[model samples]
Target: MSQQPKSSDDENQTEMYIRVKRNKTTYFLQCLPSEKVLQIKEKLQVLIDEPVNNQRLILIQTGEVLDDSKSLADQKVENDAAVALTLRKADNEFEDVNVVKPDDYIRDGDGGSNW
Candidate 1:
């Protein structure tokens, strides 16, 4: 009787070591078996000292944003998987109040000052 070959699980459990790069620094993230992508983001937030909402993490191979619902295992993150995290530029950090100074209003083409 011939014995069946060992399953993938039995042969070797694959591990994912995610590396997140921000600015000039790189943070290493070691994920547990079956860990989700969102979890990795959370870990990166702690290491990078940035808000989780402001980060844009993508799979280098697929170019897809890491979805919270998707597991790292499903993403096929192996030991060599290269994950990159970019800090998304914040929109309009300075508010446009449209404050018209009294001097500037007089310089305008509108004859509001004379009226």
Candidate 2:
């Protein structure tokens, strides 16, 4: 039997996940591509005790500053995308992108030799 093609609306409604990173921490968020940036920030607010207004999200791959008024789809943020989360500082300036990779982690042993 042949399967039916998925409609655009169906694709938009499909559950997707994105990784929100900050420093050495990563937050995997379940979201639809149709969700707005502000919505994502609100979700992050729950996990992090930070206000949405103090948070800024940037697409890691494109280095594009995500607009709170725009949808993830509109920003071309697809499934499994990595987004960097930065918070406002005391001076009211957004912090720099500081996503740390696994390679940056320092092991207790020298040269990562377990043998």
Candidate 3:
């Protein structure tokens, strides 16, 4: 007799990750498609020490600013997607997207004289 594979909990089954970038940093966060943008910001708050009110998430592909009240799926944020993270400045303005690509990194072995 043939048997089907066992399934884990629904939460684990629908788990996915997204790469959130800010400057030279990237955070890999595990989230569900149904999760709201605010939820994702809360997770970032713990890691970045920034309050959700001061945080902003933008989709890198389309330059769309994510609404905190909407779910990831509702905004078409699929798994393995890249999102830009911006923060509110003291002037109460959200900073521009500032993600740095790998090619932007300065190499140390540029053959400069140590002396």
Candidate 4:
């Protein structure tokens, strides 16, 4: 009697690929079969310069912000998962405020208004 061949599932397991987009650049993250979303975020922190806690990352498909407490496995992150980094606007109002001193308006050799 001949023996049956093993199924492909038994021979090899497929790995999930996570895609991260930062500053318009796309990064591919190859995760283990059991890796969590938080684990992936940790890896991303190393790749980007921004602080991990302050940085905003969203799921491309759902446009939902990734909760730090959640896991990638829980989110059902699978092959071709697209993750995007959203930059937060600076809170300071002075960022665009320009201050011009009175001296800046003085003309060459022009004295103050003569009475």
Winner by TM-score = 2
For all the candidates, what are their Cα RMSDs to the real structure?
16.5, 3.4, 5.2, 16.1
Q: Give lDDT: candidate 4, residue 49.
A: 62
lDDT score of residue 25 within candidate 1: 55
Q: Model 1 off-target regions past 4 Å?
A: 1-15, 92-115
Candidate ranking (lDDT, best to worst): 2, 3, 1, 4
Model 1 scores worst on lDDT over the 10 consecutive residues at 92-101
Computed on alpha carbons, the lDDT of every model, listed in order, comes to 0.64, 0.94, 0.91, 0.63
Per residue, candidate 4 scores C-alpha lDDT tens digits across 42-78 of 7777887655654656777787777766766566555
Instruction: Evaluate residue 3 in candidate 1 and report its C-alpha lDDT on the 0 to 100 scale.
Output: 60
Model 4, C-alpha of 115: deviation from truth (Å): 70
Indicate the TM-score of model 2.
Answer: 0.84
lDDT of 3 by residue, 2-95 (tens): 9556456444347789999999899999999989999999999999999999999999999999999998989999999999999999999999
Over 4 Å off in model 3, which ranges? Answer: 1-13, 106-115
User: Model 1, clash count?
Assistant: 0
Candidate 4 colliding pairs, count: 1
Two-way TM-score contest, 2 vs 3, winner: 2
| Tens-digit lDDT track of model 1 for 51-102 | 7676667776776667766777676666756666766555724222122334
Index of the highest-lDDT prediction? 2
Candidate 4 Cα errors over 4 Å, as ranges: 1-14, 92-115
Evaluate residue 34 in candidate 4 and report its C-alpha lDDT on the 0 to 100 scale: 56
